[model samples]
Target: MGASSPPRVTGRLRRTSLVDQAIAALQAEIDSGAWAVGEKIPTEPQLVERFGIGRNALREAIRALVHSGLLETRQGDGTYLRATSEFAGALRRRTSCSELLELVEVRRAIEVEAARLAAKRRSDRQAAELERLLAESAAAWRAGDVGRLVGADVALHTEIVRASGNAMLLELYESFGGAIAEAIRTELLDTATYSRPTHSALVAAIVAGDPQAAAAATAAALDEVRIGRERRSIGQPSR
Candidate 1:
């Protein structure tokens, strides 16, 4: 049969096997939670070392994950873990409109109490951390870096939740992080609204050890989001 076709020599099968193995290895990294969503993944060389595979195979694996919505490549900004999986990606996409408003409400409920408890029980170290994040958020706001602004706000609020000394509450807030990020970004896109999280007030309250003030400040921050969303939905100009 045509000289046995030279034993059907082809690197195709080997390449396919290597790509598949790299894909599997990358999945394990996502599932392990060491690589978080929205965080940039390691460099190509680092990934090659991590997967013990060729660079080409790793690129194919990353491309596949990107096509699957699990990764995102930001043109010279490096690749980021966009989602834990396809299902999570779809879930995040669906968090909009009324569902997102409901989530904001949920955040208000959790964060109000968290700020209250944090004010009553926070350590000096935690308070300082909150102050640091507040300054970072302010700087980001001034610099017009929406991503950093949202990140700092998220970290600042998470610190408040952490100071509450309630592990369960902190976990819940962390789990909602992706959706919350979307909400913050959307609101921030409307520069006219400018309704940002009340960082200075909230941090001041927490630092001052005033439960009522801390809770009030948190509520005010979230209320800005809600009010802006409502005005936009009604096609009204920002006040």
Candidate 2:
């Protein structure tokens, strides 16, 4: 928490052509879960119609997403979503594997402090958003949809970091989000998905302004994820 209030946008973003607008629109729909990873977007004609933009703008948008690794076009098969975010796409393109544990460690270091700051400074609106994201994560857990769970879980953590009001922290956490989601899917997909109370408890602590509790909760949640990854590495049972 700082003495100054949270930063505000002083002015609207500069207006752009239909191509930029289409790009933003497409990313918004994708981020909103309109299409899960690996799903094909509507056909080009359908997208062109949906966005009410010319073919050129839509194609430019598609190409940008493809370059960003958010979408992939297969010859004769149509363009399919490959990753949910640019960070995730970058992760997939890596020729060398980054250790998942290393990623989790960085996340733990960032999120623990973030949680404390969030508890101190989160607005009621931010708390409500955390509640909504928590419910989404819980629902994904209930459905046993690991993919959805990963998205919702990452979103929850990212929201907490955002609420901390630290732009740098938020950027670091976002960069790690893809690997964190991957770690969850790899390590906790089978076990501990519901083994402990996590998002709910963290939300409670933050909303209550209990910074200590918030920090404890975040560290515990990340530790649980790390332990799961360790258990798999050692060929131990999830329990």
Question: What is the model-wide C-alpha lDDT for candidate 2?
Answer: 0.80
Per-residue C-alpha lDDT of model 2 across residues 1-239, encoded as one tens digit per residue: 86998676443332246779889889988878898666788998998888888787788889999999888899998998777789878764542224776677777899999999999999999999999988888888788777787777778888999999999998767655545666666655456455338767899999999999999999998788678767777888655
Clashing pairs in 1: none
TM-scores for every candidate against the unseen true structure? 0.75, 0.66
Q: Which number leads on TM-score?
A: 1
**Model 1 misplacement above 4 A:** 1-24, 31-33, 43-45, 53-70, 74-78, 83-91, 192-197
Listed per candidate, the RMSD to the true structure in angstroms reads 5.4, 12.2
Q: Which whole-number lDDT from 0 to 100 does residue 92 have in model 2?
A: 49
Give the per-residue lDDT of model 1 (tens digit) for 157-203. 88999999999998777766666777777777864233335677888
Q: Candidates' lDDT values, in order?
A: 0.82, 0.80
